[model samples]
Target chain A: MAELDLDSADGRREALRRMVTIRAFDQEAGNRFADGEIPGFVHLYIGEEAVGVGTCASLESDDYIASTHRGHGHCIAKGLDPKYMMAELYGKAEGYCNGKGGSMHIADVDAGMLGANGIVGAGPPLATGAALSIDYQDRDQVAVGFLGDGAVAQGQVHEAINLASTWDLPAIFVVENNHYGEGTPVEKQHNLDNLSDTAQAYDIPGVTVDGMDITAVAEAVAEARERARAGDGPTMVEAQTYRYRGHYEGDEEPYRDDEEVERWRDQDPIESFKDRLIERGELTQEEFDDLRAEIEASIDDAVEYAQETDAPEPSAAYEDMFVEQPPELERFANVARTDGGANGGDHR
Target chain B: MTAQAELEQETETMTVREAIRQGLREELERDEDVYLIGEDVGVFGGVLEVTGGLYEEFGEERVRDTPISEAGFMGAATGAAATGTRPVVELMFSDFMGVSMEQIMNQMAKMHYMFGGKAELPVTVRTTEGGGMGAASQHSGTVHTWIAHFPGLKAVAPGTAASAKGLTKAAIRSNDPVFVFENKMIYEQSGEVPTDEDYTVPIGEAAVEREGEDVTVVATQRLVGESLGVADSLEGDVSVEVIDPRSLYPLDTDTIVESVEKTGRLVVADESPLSYGTHAEIATRVQEEAFFSLDAPIQRVGTPDTHMPFSPPLEQEVLPGDDDVRAAIERIA
Candidate 1:
């Protein structure tokens, strides 16, 4: 590959800003979820920020992505507003799904974020479909599936890989292997040493990279996107990363020792990337401080916006059930009412 | 104009199979975004030959022949639907839905609603259902009732040649995901279809095939034919009204209720198993709406609640037939 101008000051600053925003958003959301202000289960994306930012930065807004339960970082990296995302978490009307879908189902179709699926390994097949849509529509866009190491065991993922390879679909499968599938290490769960070996079965190239290093992830994703655009087929990129926080907001680190978490945090992606940029003369300390300040301000604004947003009306539940009013809903509602009325008569 | 003149103006003759083929051909010609994808759908002309010669005409891209992986292809179809292409996936047989139920139940069915109605999955799954082909228990069975149970899906079963064409066209045009259950038995069955070439019947509506005064016969798919046969046989002694619910999910119970209100008796004929099936649902809805008008108890004629038997005699005994429908109608009348 030709030498890319990714080491520029603007590029480094943009990457840092995105990564910081993701971390801030995840932390804030985690706190809110713990306080009982947010509805539904949430999986924080605190430590895996670099992987999302680096991969998404290589593509355009027209490109597509299917995310996992731990999807806040992917949503931020793909350019979705944090205010609406937070509102969604709060189960307020201002949320992306109008409060119908909470944290696990957050989505903005206009931003090309298909959804943060509740089912494990469900994103791959949906991403494959999105890639097929792009190819069928005759566009040069590609679809990315962001999955975790735990999702590798799902049969749907293998089915998706086979389809993508056979049809030569414009798809990129990114596995953010955090070494643990909620506590069980990958070594104990599967027969293979690396998840990338699974990609070889589908006749696609697989690459492993340093998930903590945003630069390395960016290079891998850029190459995969290029190959997809050229109609070469799908690629699998595994990023070996870690999570600083527990899977959910209140999970105790009983399964793993605190020392392991501390070890991974010491090599934080944002700090490491910052050091590399300064060492290479790509960005100065003053510029980095300004970028950090800007990101903090953005996070503050998003929190304020979410806090002030109005809650959805109870009647809103009936809305968006279908594109048009389905007769089944009316019939079901009528049955409920009739059964209630017959039992109560005139009690009220 | 008189009602007779209007009927003459709207009627033409064709086979149910040709009507379906014409529906696909017309839609493909009308919309560039519409395409077909399934196993052996392109070159092999489909296993049942419902999609014959479409591959040669539309070429490889539009009429695609996929590998024998239902889960993979169905997922791709779901993705295509979300991204803007209106894909019609041929599942070949309704029994094959078991292999790709995740795509149908979890992904495609829930995406639009889960995304806060930001998306529309305008995909149609055309599959052959109902038993008559003697292909044994595995291949021949009516699973339309099973699909109708899902909230996000629209289940459609067309009984006539004209309805087969019109409803197929409407299903393709619908913004919601539609399951078009084409009975294997009705493909070769002939009737009067419109020659105008652009005719279509809207979903969520029922059609009254025969109007009478004594008993209302509610039927779907091939059972519509059996109901009509029984209706004809009982014309002199018992006045029977046959009502075909073309689309089951968004059921036009109002029409069925109206017929029952007039006739004051009801008999539901279905091909699925008796337990918690379409017949049970239709009966419940009708009783809710027109309970006072009923002169006799609401009756359902369907197969026994068991795995479809392979033995011809056992299958015959379990499946609801002309005799069972007639018995229900007679008891109600």
Candidate 2:
């Protein structure tokens, strides 16, 4: 594996930019979801931006990724247009999934962003499959599956890991150990303190990195990607992180102490990266302000674009339900007609 | 029959299992994207030898043999499907679906819908089902009805060699996840299957195996053969119409109802346990649709609601055979 130039001034500046983008996107989405501008459940990837940005920086457009419910950061990292993502959250016709998939299901196949799954531990199996495709098609592309500490308990994850090991799949399983599974800490849920131990059972190399450091995360992921490309099978990387927000938007802070949350916030990845850039004299205050303004303007444009986009047509609900409707559908139609209407009186 | 027709039939003599193998070989040759994956699918020749010689022809990658972990390979098939690869995974046995029910029900069945229809899963899971093979309770249960209960899945069971070959091809071509259930007992059953390499039997369509006017005998899976047998034995006395519903989920209820409407009576013969089986579902649907046309109450011929016994006599008593089907038809007629 090539040594990561994290010490470079340019690398520091880019890390700062990614953190800013992720923070801004999450904040905007959080507000939109709370205000009912966005539809469906939205799990903001607020405090854990470094993991997505750092790991994704090692990937290309052809490489695939399977994301968790907290997927905004992953989407941005994979180069999905913020405007279209916001539109998708807003349930607009121009959204990535044509408004059919809301916040929890945003996807762009062109970017190799397989949709963020609603089911825990679902992404690993999918990523494993995508890796199989890469192998079958004889491509150098690798697949990454993102999961939370909570998802590690899922049986499917174990199944996926076993298959990945057995077939020597070019895949990486990243577990963002954010200390909580919806307000319940990892200590209360799992027996083992370190999630990396799970990866060792599959005979794959497992490493733990500081999630708050973008440079460290990036270095780890870069090595994993190289190992995958060289046909060394799968790797498991556990990034120790903390979530600043409640499990969702409206939860009261009943699970932890205020001091702990404050301590984590003080070590925020974005602010730390910015400080590193400033100390190295790589980016001036004026340049930082300009980058901030540019990102804010782009975010504002995305919001405006989403707000102006139209909602999907009602007929879209019936369309694409099947690849090809069976002739026996006429029976359902007849049954529906006798029950008062073709939609069984609930056309809407 | 004409002398020319007799000679033509002689050339086409092949077992349902052989026809299925031929169909698989033809498909493998035609499409490079197609591949087979399952336990013992390679050198072991699939448990029943339905996939015999495929390993030698396609090599290890295409005719891959997987570990006993159904969930892992089944999930792999789903992933493979999403990536534009058509994988035909064998479940080894219908009863073993419990191991990978999550992949079959949640992922494979719901991917297209959950992904908002952006992707299509063109994967097929072929497995042996039903009793009469003497594989007993654990190995020989008929669980097609359990799969048919799911909405997104398409379940198929072909009785004849011709339909088996054609339907297997169709199931492979379908964009959705299709469960193809082959009867273990009918593997050696011979019939005149089409020699055409591209032939296909449409899914969710009912085949009128035998025509009659007195009563409709709706059957699926291995019971289709039993229904046909019952139809032949009652040829002189009672005219029994046999209807084979090849696919179960998108069931051809219309055809069954139409047949019931014509015959004014219905009897569904199923190899699964009598309680809450496909036979019950079909019987209820037929009665509901053609109630006014029915001359008698809809009846079902199926195994008593019990686990398949190991003993031959007990197994015979537990499973719905030709005698049971004949008795059911006679009562309805």
What would the per-residue lDDT of candidate 1 be over residues B1-333, giving only the tens digit for each residue? 111222354676778888898899999998989999998999999998988988998988899988888887888888778888899999988999999898888888888877778888899999998665566778877888878998788989998887899889988998889999998888888888776656777788888888889999988888888898999998899988898888898888788888998999999888888898898888887777677788899998887876667777777777778899998887867
CA deviation > 4 Å runs, candidate 1: A1-5, A282-290, A331-348, B1-12
Clashing pairs in 1: none
lDDT per model vs. reference: 0.84, 0.82
Q: Please give the range of 10 consecutive residues that has the lowest summed lDDT in model 1 chain A.
A: A339-348
Candidate 2 - CAPRI tier? acceptable
Number of backbone clashes in candidate 1: 0
Candidate 2 Cα deviation (angstroms), residue B212: 1.5
Assess every candidate by TM-score.
Answer: 0.95, 0.92
What pairs collide in candidate 2? none
Highest TM-score model number: 1
Candidate 2 per-residue lDDT, tens place, A1-348, comes to: 222246566655666777788788888888877887876678888888889888887776578898888888889877788989888888888888888777887887667888787877788888888888787777878899899999998888898888888888899999999999988899988999789888779999889999988877888888888898899999999999998888777778699998998999888988787787878788877888899889888988999999998988865655554576654455455555545433231322
